[model samples]
Target: MLAKAIFLDIGGIVLEINWRKTVEALGVFDRSQQDQIWSVLGSAKIHLELERGNATPQEFFAFVRSELKLSPEAPLEEAWNQLILGPLPQVDQIFDRYAGRVPLYALSNTNRPHYDYFMKQFPVMKRFDRILTSFELGHRKPDSEIYMAAATEVGLSPSEIVFIDDSPANVDAAGRLGFRSFHSVNSVSATLEILQRHFSN
Candidate 1:
């Protein structure tokens, strides 16, 4: 089937964010402690709160510290920002290659600061056919409405589009809505190759 649209997730897919690195950066720790930190880090409820501006980074750190019973003196904000590093390399090159060839959109659960940061750092985001942000959209992923909103914004059926996200839940949600989806564990090179193969013929 021809791809009528492409939806990319910002945080993990286009931006190379290593969330576990935040816990590791907190200095050497035993396996048990690491496990505790990892557990808090993977909680979607925490991320949803963070992305919605309902919880500050400091609050998040406190919550994690409380969960792990770690020192309250931990450098939470810095450590959290450490995980949210810069964008992936050659992201623009990939976007440039595919932008106008097909309708392209970005769907992310991000806050105002990060959204502003991205717009300033990468002007190419402005080039997308549409940008659906949870902070702005009031709808987040793993929710069919967000995917439907994206499809509606682009005037395409979900089945005609491909959604790329780091979260399997989000991919599965889109899949249920008739979208062709991929979990973005592989490199963008792999993703581009897949898209090229599908459209080249």
Candidate 2:
């Protein structure tokens, strides 16, 4: 089906993130310690709470410091911000090819700090017609509520929108909701091809 609009994911699709980098930045060099730290930081509950706007960034940092036994002066915020490496390669091609053809929206599960950091650092973000973040909406991906809310906000049925995300679960969730969804798998070129194939006309 021809898409009336497009929803793209940010973290893996538009940007590259390294959880290990954040761990290292936090001064954790031991492999096992890094794994354990990342596991805690990346847990579904903690991530969901933060991205769902249920917890403030200050609360998150404080929890991390306390749980990880970090020094009182540890640069928690700075290191956490390091999770976003930068934009992916050739991401511009997606906008270059599809912008103005249809509404392009960014749908991401991100907290305030990372959202602010990426928005400031990446000029490409300005290309989206709108941005829908979990933190802003109080819902995260793989949940029907967020996708339904997004569809409602865009004034379209799920079937009319093309949703692209790197997470298989998110793609499946959108598809189950009747969205024309694609799993980008961290490849901008593949996402572009899918858009071109379905929406190029």
Choose the strongest candidate by lDDT: 2
Error of 1 at 26 (Å): 4.2
Return the clash pairs for model 1, or none.
none
lDDT of each: 0.74, 0.88
RMSD of model 1, in Å? Answer: 3.4
Residue 3 displacement in candidate 1 (angstroms): 3.0
Candidate 1 per-residue lDDT over residues 1-201, each given as its tens digit: 677888889877777777667777787357687677677666647667776567665666667687656786776655665566666777776677887788788988876656766677667678778878876655678877778877887788998898888888998999999998888753777667667755542
Residue 121, candidate 1: how far off, in angstroms? 4.1
* Candidate 1 stretches greater than 4 Å from native: 25-32, 44-46, 52-75, 121-127, 198-201
lDDT of 1 at 32: 81
Using all chains and alpha carbons, the TM-scores for the candidates as numbered come to 0.75, 0.96
Off by over 4 Å in 2: none
